[model samples]
Target: MSQLNRVAWIVTVGSCLVAALILVLSGYTGYAGVTLAVAIAAAINLF
Candidate 1:
């Protein structure tokens, strides 16, 4: 993979981890939003 792709994956994983942590602390209410946001971010990096 290219350097940019590597960086993007790192950011995506980091954000997902952060989101998971937030969901854990805040409960399921945040789960859907965080998951959706992470999915969109990851999807964008695919192109």
Candidate 2:
């Protein structure tokens, strides 16, 4: 894969992992909003 593609993949995975961690730590509340935002960001990067 190209460098840009690798970077995008990393960002998407990292963001999702962080969001999941945040959600888990917060008892599945509060930062639920971040999950959506991160998913949108990842989807945008796909193009």
Q: Supply every candidate's count of residue pairs whose N, Cα or C atoms clash at under 3 angstroms.
A: 0, 0
Candidates' C-alpha lDDT:
0.72, 0.73
What tens digits encode model 1's per-residue C-alpha lDDT throughout 1-47? 69889788778867776777777777775685767577677767756
> Across residues 1-47, which tens digit of lDDT does each residue of candidate 2 receive?
58889687778867786887778787885566667567767766656
Flag regions of model 2 displaced more than 4 Å.
29-47
Q: Which ten residues in a row have the lowest lDDT in candidate 1?
A: 27-36
Worst 10 residues of 2 by lDDT: 29-38
Q: Where does candidate 2 clash, by residue pair?
A: none
lDDT winner: 2
Give the number of colliding residue pairs in candidate 1.
0
Residue 18 alpha-carbon offset, candidate 2, angstroms: 0.5
